[model samples]
Structure formats: structure tokens, C-alpha cells
Target: MHPSRRAVLAGTGLLPLALPLLGQAVTPVRAEPAALLRRAIPSSGETLPAIGIGTSRRYEVAPTPEAIAPLREAVLRFVALGGSVIDTAPSYGTAEDVLGLILAEPGLREKLFLCSKVGTPGREAGLAEIERSFKRMNTAMIDLVAVHNLIDTAMNLATLRDLKAGKRIRYVGVTVWRDSQFADLEAVMRRETLDFVQVNYALDDRVAAQRILPLAAERGIAVMVNVPFGRDRLLKAVQGRDLPPWTAEFDCASWPQFFLKYVLAHPAVTCPIPGMAKVAYVEDNLGAARGRMPDAALRARMETYVDAL
Candidate 1:
């Protein structure tokens, strides 16, 4: 049996709050249908859900029903709860294949703002990888395609632009997995007409905020934040700790929301894609988009609180 939301979080220093937004039986949380927050993609003015799912290590699983049932439920229920963005990549092993199968369910793909990546060097190789991604993800046109980790970025970005011009992809951008590579990412952001840039930013991992985020805002580019929990490092650090009483002011009910809300509260963040394959965890993460986001002062307090942990 899939664990209840509370069961999934039993020992992680947090009690799962009832999620009015999630109605799946796989997740025990219950409440009314509170809408997930929506923010505009600056380049196009199209809106997307403030919270999204990331298919990385969590989704590189066999496509058998026994292996896929939970991940499928998570994706389907995420859309039911109003999530629109789903980011995957060619490097994520069987993730795109599994996602293609799950999203094949009637009306699923249309409801999603599907994003994928390509990392090959030459234009022809990049095009081949993108075509493979399209086949793996079962889509004719991808909403966005980024150059993964800035691999052959100039060539890839040019390729992405050509694809965009031909209407093969809706948007073109780049991604930076590590904070140390911010200089290259920054240079590209300034030089290219990108629609998005995926970067890592949790309360503990604030390097992106120092410049990338603000620059994206300045340049009318959208920001998709990855590794919002410091790639699980923050979760490990907060284990067995108590939720501070003050978190209620902004309606944060769990650790995931607390971490996600911190990222969401930043004006420049278009979405925070936390890697979650469990329905219960998806329910918990979606709640971050429903409540009062912390103001700058509250955000400062949150940083200090988490920093001292």
C-alpha cells in the first residue's frame, strides 16, 4: 500500500498537514480544493504553477506496472491538484520513458507544461537527442528545451533557437547544476534570449539568489529553481528537529512547504521543481503554493532559523 502523507513523513521531524488541494486516496491528507499558486513566465506572459515536480533520481525506474504505479499516481494527482510544470531530461535514465507511458493517459499531456533537456555538442547531435527526448516523452512539441549543465551551450542554444523558430519547441534556455558554474551561466544569460534558466536554490543554497535570480528578473527571463531542499542536505540536517511555532503566520504546515515557500517567496522565482515521486510527498509540496508566502522580513527570519540549524 502507498503510505499516507502522515505515514510518509512519520520520522522526518514534521507532521503532515491536511492538504485541501489533494484528493487522492493514496495521500491521507484531506481538505478542500485550494488552488496552487500561479506565476507568469516573463518571456511569454504564460502562467505556470508555482510548484512543480522534478524527475531525476526518483524517477529512473523500470517501466513495469509494479514499479510505475506510485509514480504514475503522483503525476496524475499532481495535475489534479493544478500542477502544470513537469521537468525531465535525457540523462535521467528511464524517467522520460516512464513519464511518457504515464502521461499517455487521456488528456494528461495537454494539461502539463512539459520541459526536457539536451546535452549533446554538435547541432546535429543535439537535434538527434531532442528528437529522442520527444519520442521518449511521447510529445510532438516540447514546451521548453534547455541545454543541460551548459554543455556546448553556444551551439545548443543556437540549435534551440532554430527549433523554436521552426515551432518544434516553444522556448529555449540553459541549466546550471552547481553554484560554482554560475559565472558561465551568467554570461550565457546575458548573451542569449532565453525563456528559462533552471538553477539550485534552497534556504541553505542561496548562491542563485545573489545574482542569477535578480538578473533573470531584470532580463525578463523565467527562473525554474531545482534542488530547493539543498539536494536533500537540508532535509538531513533538520531530521528530528521541531517545527517552530512561528511558521503558522504564513500557513506553512510541513518541512517541504517551509523549504518550498522560502524559494517561492522570492519575487524572481517562477517555480521550484522539487524531485518527488510519491503521491504523499507531492501533496505536501503542493501545499507550499496555497498559503501566504513570507514577506522579505519573514524570509530573513526563516534564513536565520534554518542557518542556525
Candidate 2:
């Protein structure tokens, strides 16, 4: 359920303590339990927490206990603080492995709306990779599985369909992070029966917004935004600039929140899976899901503001 105005109180005690983020303890955003925004999967109507964790560069750690300790803590805190979506892939080095170990932490796996991808081509290879993903993530079933970059889209998607039909997976999706693949992504969206589509959309990168997002909504496919910050290009673009005072009209607090809120405000977006490497960052990003979202007018202003920078 999406958080309501009655739920966005100053202190609902959502975050009780400061958490370690990159070894620096910082005040986590105080959120309301009822206000933590969630969006439904158009396929199964399963709602997901709006902010998701992305294990790309962050979770590719040395699988030793010491090196994996911080990541484990972050994942636990993320779930503790009302987060559920966790996206990982086999191509992301030891990310799947790290999550496998982290999943062993009692009661964590079931709490997550876990998502992984199958990047390899061919039927057998795709099936094998999906099987290995389950082994690597230490789960018998995953909530959602996507075709990484829409790779060999036909065969891989066919495999995902079989897995879903067998109840081995709950939902099937395809991902496209590059603008060049927009044609391919949209074609699949129009042709296939999909529960979700993971794509790159952000304050700076609005190209996907032009058509892809609308298509997802029209097709009834849930949308998960990847690289909402445009891979940090948006962050670096706004560095040292004070957030426009008018931003507070919608309850936007920080630049990161601004970036994320801009994406989430779109009627079509389900969640923006930003890569939060630390516990503090995760808390900060969740703030976007708590406050009043910017309206369409504010969204236009945001684009103008960023383009001027």
C-alpha cells in the first residue's frame, strides 16, 4: 500500500537509531511504518517496497566473513526498515554468492522480493544459469527473474515462462539499461506477457520516460527503475548546488531524495532500485518513499532545473 499523508508524520519511530554508512555513523531518515510506499505488481498484484537494493558493485565482495559482515548488516537493516526488493545478477561477480550467505541469516530470504537475471543465451544455458542463480542465492524460489539486458530475449524469456508455469518462479521480466536497446525492450513489452520490466530512468536520463514507461503502464507491466541517478551522473551534476527552495513544497529533503522522488512520482514507476552500498544510504533513499511525491508540474520543473545545470 502507498503511504498516505496521515502516515508521513515527523517521527513515527521508523528509524530508531543511527546506522553505519561507509563506516561513518549518520542519522537515518525517520519514516512512518504506514507511510513507506509500496507499489503492486501488475501481474500478481503483489505490492513491493518502493526502494530496492541493487547488488552490482557493492555486493561483489570477497566471500570471507570479515569482508561480508558490513553487507550482511546492511541487508538486515534494509529489511528491518521496511525494504523488500533486492535485485542481483550472476554477472555481478560474487554478488549472488554474497547474497547466498546473507540469505542464510534466518528469516531474511522470505522477507525479500528477490530478483535475479539470466544473461546467457540458448535454452539449456539459460535454464542452467537460472538454476545456478537459485543455488547462488540460496533460495528454492525467487520472486522475480529478468532477462539481463534483454539478451537473446526470445529463448531466455521462453525459459523464464516455463519456470514460472512450473511455479519455480513467481514472475518473469526483461531488463534493458541502455538507450540503444529501447527498440528491443519495447518490442518485447508489446509482444510478451510480462510481470515486470527493469529499465534505466532518472532525473537526468529521461529518454526512457518518453516511451518505455508509458508502454509498461499500457501493457500492465510493473516497472523497476535501475540507475535512477543515471549512474551518479545526476549526483555529480548537482554537486555543490543547493536544492531549489521550492522543492520543500512536495517534502523533498535532499538531492538524492530529489533524484529518486522525480522517478517515483511518475504514475508508471513501481520502484527505483538504487545501489545503496551502505546502511545509511539505504535509509536516506527510503526517505523518497515516505514523503509527499512531486506532482506533474513539479516534475517538469525538476527537468528544467536539471537541464539548466
Candidate 3:
């Protein structure tokens, strides 16, 4: 049984609230459809759900029956809740193999917009890695392949471009998680005709908002936000705090939604992929996609509230 349905579940991940928007009382959101929120890929205008799931530390596990059961359940729940994108990397040990198992089952691949990365730094190594990715993912065509952290970026992007041209891959781009690497990331973004750019951005790490996000908007590149919870640091910071009552204005019902909605509220953010290890947590994370998003005013208020904390 999924823990979420075991009881009427609610969360307050140390969230803070200020005065209600225009003093409006919290209105209930009971009958909203299960539709997930979506944003457009600037390059092709194709829409993707604004929330995605990541498989990093959470997914690097041995291929035992006990280990895969919950991971499998979380994935199915993610899709059932209107999620489409699933991000992974070769560096995430055994994640690709595990994901291949899930994807090879019936209709799962068609339902997901999959993205993987080649973190190796040489031409042959990068090529070898992506080929392995193809076989491991059990897909002849990958949706997106990025040069992780821009290692040997030019070479990897070149390879991905060739693959894209051959229709072996649909999009090519790069990813970076550290602020120290943003300059190099921007340099590559400025020089390449990329389809996507993955970067870190959370309530705690808003550096991407200043340049990377705006540049993506200007370059017509889709943005995938990583580390939305500051790799769990933000969650730890807000531990035991109460959610603001006015969060309902933007349809935020829990702390996870508060963090995710903050990232999704940005126009340039296509999706924020938060990793989950449990079916119930996946359901909880997906809840962020169902409600109203914070507008500019509320976003400012949210930033201020988190900053104060």
C-alpha cells in the first residue's frame, strides 16, 4: 500500500507565510483535475510537464527484486500523476540498467520524455558512453542527450549534434550544478545551438535565475532545473517549520510544493526534476503540478520569506 493513501496526508516542510495576497483567505482546492502543469520548449514549442523526476543517488542500486519494487512503484506513480520526463546519467551507477528494465516493459518508454548524460571527457569515450546509454535505456532514439557538467563539452555536443541529425537523438545540450561552473556553461550556451540547458536552482540556490535562465530564454533553449531542494539542504533548513496559510493562492499545499512551485513560477524554467525514492514521495511531489502557481508578487514574497529563514 502507498503510504500517502494510508491516511489523509499533509506536510509543512518548514514553510513560512506572510500576509495573504490582498488579504484573501485560503480557498480550498478539492476538485481540480489531475492534469499536470506544462511549459513549452522554446526551440520547438512542444509542451512538457513542468515537473520531472531525477534518478541520481536515489536510483543507484543493485538489481535485486526488493530494491526495484519501490523504485518501480515510484516511477509508475510519477507517470500516473501526469509526469513525462525522467532524467538520468551514466554516472548514476546502475540507474540506466534499472531504468532500462522499467522502460522495456510495455508502454512505459512512449509515456516518458527521457534525458541522459555523457559525463566522460573524450570523443571516443563520449561516443561509447551514449551508445551504452542507448542499449541500456533500451531505446533506439533518445529524447535528449547532454554533456554532463560541460566536460569536453565541444566534442560531446558535436557528437550529440551528429546523432540528432541522424534522428538517433532529438535534442542536444549541457548541464551544470555548481555556480562556479556557470561561466563556462554560459560560454557554451552562447556558442552552441542547443535545445536544452540543465542547471541547479532551488529556493536556496537562485544563481541560475540571474543569467543562465535569461540566456536560455534569449537563446530559445528549454531549461531543466536541478537541485530544487538544494540537494536536500533546503529541506533540512525548513525542517519542522509550518507552511504559510496563504500558500493556497498559488495552490501550494505542502513544503515540497512550495519549493517546486517557486522554481516553476519562473517563465524560463521548463521543469524542475526532483528525485524521489518512494511511491508516496513521488505522489507528494507530483501534487505541486496540480495547483495555481505563484505570480511575480507572491514569488517575491516567497523569496523574502525563505531569505528571512
Ranking of all candidate structures by their lDDT, best first: 1, 2, 3
| Tens digit per residue, CA lDDT, model 3, 118-146 | 99988899999999999987899889999
lDDT of 2 by residue, 1-309 (tens): 223223333446557365576887766565545457889888778898899999999899999899899888888878988999999999999999999999999888789989999999999998999999999888999989999998899999899998998988999999988899999888899999999999999988899889999999999999999999999999999787777889888787678889999999998999999987777777678878986899999999999999988
TM-score of each: 0.90, 0.89, 0.89
lDDT of 1 by residue, 1-309 (tens): 223334533535333465455574333444455688899999889999999999999999998899999999999889988998999999999999999999789989899999999999999999899999999988898999999999999999888988999998999889988999999999999988889999988999998988999999999999999999998988888777767878888977778788999999999999999998988888889988987999999999999998898
TM-score of 1: 0.90
Candidate 2 TM-score, C-alpha based: 0.89
Better of 1 and 3 by TM-score: 1
- Identify the candidate with maximal lDDT: 1
Kindly report which residue stretches of model 3 are placed more than 4 angstroms away from their true locations once superposed.
1-33
Give the clash total for candidate 3: 1
* Deviation in Å, model 3, residue 289 alpha carbon: 1.5
Q: Output the lDDT of residue 261, model 3.
A: 89
